[model samples]
Target chain A: MIPLSWYLILAAGLFCIGLFVVLTKKSAIGILIGIELMLNAVNINLAAFWHYYTQLNPSQTPLNGMVFLAIVFIVAAAETAVGLALIISAYRRRNTSVAGEMDLLKG
Target chain B: MTAMQIIFLIVAAVTLGGALMIATSRRMMHTVLWLVLTLMGVAVLFALLQANFFSVVQVLVYIGAIAILILFGVMLTRRSMVDAGESLVHKNWWVVAVVIALLFAAIVISIQPWGAAHTPLVELMEFKEPISDLGEALVDPAAYLIPFEVSSVLLLAVMVAAIYIAVDRKGGKS
Candidate 1:
């Protein structure tokens, strides 16, 4: 039987890697990828917790975790769409996809 | 170690390795490919956790829609497929690494004291059709209906917003 902490630790590592990519990557698309990874890590945490919670409380029907995760999926999809649109728009105007180079408002 | 534990370790390693590759891959196309690999590994983890619906959705939504969108973003943004001669990482990336390390340690320490953290999963019989329960819960008035409807509206708004933002506005100055 796999303990709950294993899932938590895996999520922590995934989230940290996402954070590293978000902070260090120079491309805006790379940052978007990091955000996706972080969201996935959060999804894993939610599912794992829900699994354990249902296990501990077998008498109750608690599907809230799955519902919440589904909502997150919606959010992730919406975010990716809007985010890539914004990136494309920025690239069109600024003529670059590098994050540091988009400093139009850096007066 | 047990077979389940061994499988978990292999999946975790593959997932983490793919994520690491996404961060380090030089070409935008290669990064997107790595993202696909990482997302697939995550989907497999979802299956291992017995969240089969999520595993399927992860593949359909994430890999099917999102990864392709990112690939299009890569293609539309760059004239060349490869990001040659460009520095991929920020100059102060070590600072970010130290901060992430501290964050990871903090998370591990915080999770250590939870009594539930050590507990193993219950038997499959205990679940009794969790997918159906999830479907019902989403539409149940007493449960997640509002959030579900709101997410639908959010998706509609996102579609409109994406189209508006990405449309090439010709002959417009400033």
Candidate 2:
């Protein structure tokens, strides 16, 4: 069994990279991809902890992490669907998918 | 090195490298491909942690569904399928590097003590199938029934909203 910390570190790395992409990407869909990456890191953490914690307490391994992870999967799929749909809608109106160009609500 | 350790290194490298490519790639197709690669790495990582169900979900949901959705979005929105110029916002590399370095350092330092008390694994894993437990938990009154029902409702609402927002009934041809 690998040390739990290694998984944690890897998740952290994935998250930071995602954050960088989110902060820097000009396209709205690119930002969405970054968010997916961050969510993936979170799922990794949840599963890794579940792995270790359940090992220590085999009698009482709560299914919350796994449940939450499954829920996240569903939510991510829905969000991606709606988000890209919105982006396409926005593209039709504004003729651009660039984040900076999406200033309709700007004061 | 142990087999697990070796697999870990390979998965982590692939994931991180793919993420880097996703961030830096100028073309949208490249970005989507890199995202797929990165998601696959994450799926392998889930398998490594013994969560075979999530690993499968990772592949099905992230790689199979989301990556294709992103590719379609990229293809549909852009006038040219190939976006030749820089698509990312011009960034100050030094500032981004400093932030990433700080974040990485904080995470590493915070987790350093956990390595000291690393628990050795039991020879045999007790629970083989977490998928069944998760299924039971979704419907079990004593468990997470509300959240499960709520997620379904949310999905329904999102589907409706996507149709509502995507369809141009008022402006364009129906």
Candidate 3:
């Protein structure tokens, strides 16, 4: 059997990579990509924890972990939609996608 | 060394490597492609964990739907951002690297209890069909009915907001 820690470690690594991407990338879409990666990491963690804990109390319904992940998936999707819409609107107003150049509301 | 470990390693490599490429790729389209690959690996990982339903959801919602939306966002959004700078901004790479490294260490250290390698894996004894139960639970007033309804409302609100923001007006370009 594969150890649950492996999944956790992988998720953590992926999360760090997402953080790096979000911090270093200049484009709004790239930041969105990083957010997606981070969300994936969270799902991995939730699934791993669920799988690990349900072993102890197999009688209880294992719906909670999956439900949490499912809800997160839905929220992440909605967040992406709104984020992309905002990014596109900003692009329309500014004519550029560079993160540094978006200084209209900075003041 | 086992089949499961090998599969996990492969998925991890694909996911992490694709994420790295997405971070460093200069072109937006390439980043999207890498994102797709990473998402696919995550789906496979979900399947390996025996959450086949969520694996399907990951493919359908993430790869099929969300990816296309991201592509549309990229295509529709900057028509000509030529000097948009490098995807991996060199000026802040060192700081970001340090931060990510510290964050990764913290997470790994914190997740030790639930996922230590010594913990043995046991088969799920009950609940033949978790997917059906999930569906039932969504509507079951004693379970997650409130969250289910709330999420639907949230999705509706988000859809309306997205449409509102993405639409163009007669003289709103400025």
| Candidate maximizing TM-score | 1
Clashing pairs in 1: none
Residue lDDT tens for model 2, B86-159? 54654675588688889889988877776543554332356676567678878988899999899999999998
The alpha-carbon RMSD over the true interface for every model, in angstroms, is 2.0, 2.3, 1.8
Candidate 1 per-residue C-alpha lDDT over B92-122 given as tens digits, one digit per residue, 9 for 90 to 100: 8889889899999999999999887888764
Report the alpha-carbon TM-score of model 1 versus the true structure: 0.93
Interface RMSD of 2: 2.3
Candidate 3 docking quality: incorrect, acceptable, medium or high: medium
Off by more than 4 A, model 3: B83-90, B110-117, B122-127, B171-174
Native-to-model Cα distance after best TM-score fit, residue A54 in candidate 3, in Å:
1.9
DockQ (C-alpha) of model 3?
0.70
What value does the interface RMSD of model 3 take?
A: 1.8
True contacts kept of each: 0.83, 0.66, 0.76
User: Candidate 1 iRMS, in Å?
Assistant: 2.0
Score each candidate by Cα lDDT.
Answer: 0.88, 0.82, 0.84
How far off is residue A66 in model 1, in Å? 0.9
Deviation in angstroms for A107 in model 2? Answer: 14
Superposed by TM-score, candidate 2 places the C-alpha of residue B77 at a distance from the truth, in angstroms, of: 0.8
lDDT of 3 by residue, A1-107 (tens): 77777887898898999988888887888889999999999999898888887876778878999889989999999999999988887788778777777889731
The number of the candidate with the highest DockQ is: 1
The DockQ assigned to candidate 1 is 0.71
Ranking by lDDT: 1, 3, 2
